[model samples]
Target: MAVTRSLSTLIFDLGNVVITWDPRPALPEQYTGQDAEDLLTRLDFFTRNADHDAGKPFAEWVADLRSSGDAEGADALQHYVDHFDRSLVGLVRGTSQLIDDLKAAGVTLYALTNWSAETFHHAQAAAPALAQFDDILVSGEEGIAKPNPEIYTRALERWDLDVRTTGFLDDSEANIAGAESVGLTTHLFTNAVDARAWARDMTGAAGV
Candidate 1:
């Protein structure tokens, strides 16, 4: 059976859902193309990213990256990180189409992302498409991250939403489970083609 109209909101994960996520988009400028993956294996961007995402102090993380590795190479890497759009992984297939479709159908749209406050605005600027969201909940800004039920709670609770009728779409299973635990319907998003199609069909059926 299709979900009902009681779930009037559609929450989307930003990175893998709307725009793509490449942790080291600028690494090739600092290292050999083949070694980019190797360096990424050794470095933990996401781990270093946690503090920023939670909206805590993050000057230390930046300093560490600036000081690691060969001074020149590290500096080169820092330059890329400072200037290039590392988060511009690419638009997930069909993201624009889906968001546009959702708005046209009168479904409320939101972006629920575990992102750093430091880089979030920069990313939004780089990807002009982010402005489409009706509500944006960034982990850093909210001081909460997903996979944590609290974050999901904030999404519905703060918005006075009916969880059982709301939709949460993310690339992470943990996040999906978290949202589901809070009585929210979730889509375990993988590829954009199927996801966008699902979004269109599901929301249409729900009359949202």
Candidate 2:
């Protein structure tokens, strides 16, 4: 059965949902070929990258990597810093249009994302479409990330939104579970196409 409700508030997750961010594309020229692959495998970029989302300072992270005798990892992290904007390829196709449609339908849009405080500005500059959101909550700024219930509560309470009527979209299952735990109508995102469809259905913005 489709659980129907008047979902007035629509919340979006930034990474992958709105913009493309694949760190592998940012590999430095010096680290190309086998060296790049080996360094990525050794550093576990995605796993350790979460530390940045958790408010870890870039300088501190690089220091730790260097101290741990992973100079290659440190260099890779520097490369990411140098190519921060490039790392985020561009906007997720169709999402900008979806935002416009949702707005036309009188649905309020907000963003709850686990993006690093230091790097978020670059994303904003790279993808001006993000500016369409009425409000945006950054986990790094709040010292908390998704999958942690506190951040969800903060976003909900900040807008004085009733969890039952608020719809939250995220690509991570764990983050979806976290939103559900807080009583939000959660959508587990697979791609922008499906995500836009679900938003339209929930907000009745299909024709708008």
Error of 2 at 56 (Å): 1.0
Number of residue pairs clashing in candidate 1, backbone atoms closer than 3 angstroms, sequence gap of 3 or more or interchain: 1
TM-score of 2: 0.93
Best by TM-score: 2
Q: Ten consecutive residues with minimal summed lDDT in candidate 2?
A: 199-208
Residue 10: error of model 1 in Å? 0.3
Per-candidate TM-scores read 0.83, 0.93
lDDT of 2 at 143: 82
| Pairs that clash in candidate 2 | none
List where candidate 1 sits over 4 angstroms from the true fold: 1-6, 64-77, 205-208
